[model samples]
Target: MTIVLHGIRNCDTMKKAFAWLDGQGLDWRLHDYKKEGIDRARLEGWVAKLGWEALLNRAGTTFRKLPDAEKAGLDAGKAVALMLAQPSMIKRPVAVAGEALLVGFDPARWSATLK
Candidate 1:
């Protein structure tokens, strides 16, 4: 399985996810969206599959710091644009394995999908 993990390396959650994948002996690719930048098409697809609420990282500083105007009354296109412009605004450790895409890390779910 080819798993692609997306997040900033410095994030604690992302660090834990990487460590877990390594311990499991899973081969995966890391996409540091902070440096490489997020693709609009990919973000759109993720949003569609995961829904805006799931994809949006409300816990992150980026999202919390957004202006009220920017945060309020978001639509799909606008949300995608925001995420693309601010990759940190998206949730951490979004993993894509084949046609399966998962946002966030839950051990139970990871075990089911990756084990």
Candidate 2:
């Protein structure tokens, strides 16, 4: 199984994820969207599995900076559009392990899902 963590390379949460995965002896790789770029197909696939609400990081600065109008109406399409325009808007460390889709950093959940 290919274990890939998607997020910015310099993000603190991403660093923690890196450490945790390394500590667990899992062979994982980082897909820094900022540098590598992300595609709609991949994001949409994740959104389909996890929901756009779970994928969109509203608490991040990128979302916070958006105008009220842009943030007002949100659905799967709008959420995907926003996240597509700004990759940073997606939650950190979205890990795709085989068929499992993990959002954010939760060691317990990751352990359970990965196991």
Candidate 3:
């Protein structure tokens, strides 16, 4: 199974995830959102599995900087559009392992899912 880890390379959370994966000795690939850029199809696929709320990074600076009007009225469609426009607004370190897509960094959840 191909394990793909997607996030900004410099993110502290991403670094921790990477370190954890490395410690586990799992072979995986990194898809840097800043470098590779995210597309609608991939984001949509993840949203379909995990829900837009799980994928959207409301805690991040990118989301905080958005105008109140822009942040308002969020449905799946609008969330996808916003996330597509700004990849950083999507949560960090979304991992795709085989057929599973995991959003955010939770060590216990990751261990369970990845195994």
lDDT of 1 by residue, 1-115 (tens): 8699999899988888998999999999899987888888888888878798889888888888899999889888878888888899889889999888889987679889887
Q: Where is model 1 poorest over a 10-residue stretch in terms of lDDT?
A: 106-115
In model 3, the runs with Cα more than 4 Å from the true position are: none
TM-score of each: 0.95, 0.96, 0.96
Misplaced by over 4 Å in model 1 are none
Residue range 42-105, candidate 2, lDDT tens digits: 9999998889999999999999999999999799999999999999999998998888889999
Candidate 1 overall Cα lDDT vs. reference?
A: 0.87
lDDT of 3 at 84: 91
lDDT of each: 0.87, 0.92, 0.91
Query: The CA-based lDDT of model 3 is what?
Result: 0.91
Candidate 3 all-Cα RMSD: 0.9
Q: What 10-residue stretch in candidate 3 is worst by lDDT?
A: 20-29
Q: Which order, best to worst by TM-score?
A: 2, 3, 1
